[model samples]
Target: MAYLFSGDGGDSDSAVVPLVCLQPFPLLLFASVPVCFILSAALVMMMKVPAFCYWFGCLFCAGMSAEMKAMAMTILYVCCISFLSFSLCIISLLWVFCSVFSAFFLCFFWVLLIVRDCLVFVWGAKIQSETCSLDSP
Candidate 1:
């Protein structure tokens, strides 16, 4: 696990750094915060559409024998309910997919940031040691 953060040479000192310290707060903030806002906006937009019940009622209630009208209305009611439920299910699934994708990228961005910091730290230490050695001779 630590090796993932430590650069090429596998330094034990780098491995000693706690995993918790490497967690990047900015990645989580950047990934989830905007997604939450966007999801809320989308939910609001979804809710603003007029309900299908009124439209279905009006369309299915006209011009038929009483028995035929009853039967047709029942079928239309079921169909409209099914279509609305299916659309809701699809929207729910899409929200879940977007959240999961954001989480994945959050972890990815955190790891990249940690690895970058480790590399810079290692390079700076190397430069300092080289300059010290040159001065000693």
Candidate 2:
């Protein structure tokens, strides 16, 4: 339809497209780095105490009932598994953050190199033209 193409060149209202900025993605990731580290450290520390307790209980609890021992062992195993999983999750987050940060810098440096080359080419041409003109005169 002609209306689709001609309705609002400048004045009439239309749906406005929102600007999406990606500049803050890396900054948000950087802010999360410390949080990931702290969480992983806390989980690791918590895991150590429970794991030591679980082993110690197994070693010394010869008279404990089978059902109670089984329940206790299950609880300890669950705790250890959960702590390890959480620590692994934090480690993976850190890995992702580092990868994204590296990629962002790699792209930024590539763009910088391209712009620098363009500027150098432009200036070199300008200088060469100026010298040629002076030599002719």
Candidate 3:
């Protein structure tokens, strides 16, 4: 999560340690966007309700944050609205707007959990490898 990444101890040893590149991790998350989109889109194709669409929209937002470009971010916003529209239709069908909103909040929480764990794993591995390299030399 951005919070964990911005936390105090995260960058403490960076004076001596190397920072990882931004390319591939963002790309990997980018590649996953289509899959999420397709799955949510499929739910729409199947005429399922809005909750699924909302959840997928959150995923799409999380993916877009990985991109550094303003244009890509704009495209992501458009995609989000499309997905939300479908989700809203579903919510209307079931007459459960409150429940759908709660689930949407929970989806965001999980996305944060995923981002935090991934950063911890990646930075921890890098630090371990650097320590090993120094010790071996």
Clash number for candidate 3: 4
Give the higher-lDDT candidate: 1 or 3: 1
lDDT of 2 by residue, 1-137 (tens): 11212123434333232212323454566676677667756645654553444554556546667676667667766775676677667667766786787668657755665676677679999999999999995
Clash list (residue pairs), candidate 3:
1-115, 1-116, 50-87, 50-90
Per-residue error (Å), model 3, residue 61? 62
Q: Which stretches of candidate 3 lie over 4 Å from their true place?
A: 1-95
| Residue lDDT tens for model 1, 1-137 | 44244443665554344443344543454465556556555544443444422443656445556687556556655655565566556556766665677568658766876887788889999999999999996
**Residue pairs with backbone atoms closer than 3 Å in model 2 (clashes):** none
Q: Give, for candidate 1, the lowest lDDT window spanning 10 residues.
A: 47-56
Superposition TM-score, candidate 3 onto the true structure:
0.31
Which has the greatest lDDT? 2
TM-score of each: 0.54, 0.52, 0.31
RMSD of each: 10.1, 13.1, 22.1
Error of 3 at 27 (Å): 40
Candidate 2: count of backbone clashes, pairs at least 3 residues apart or interchain: 0
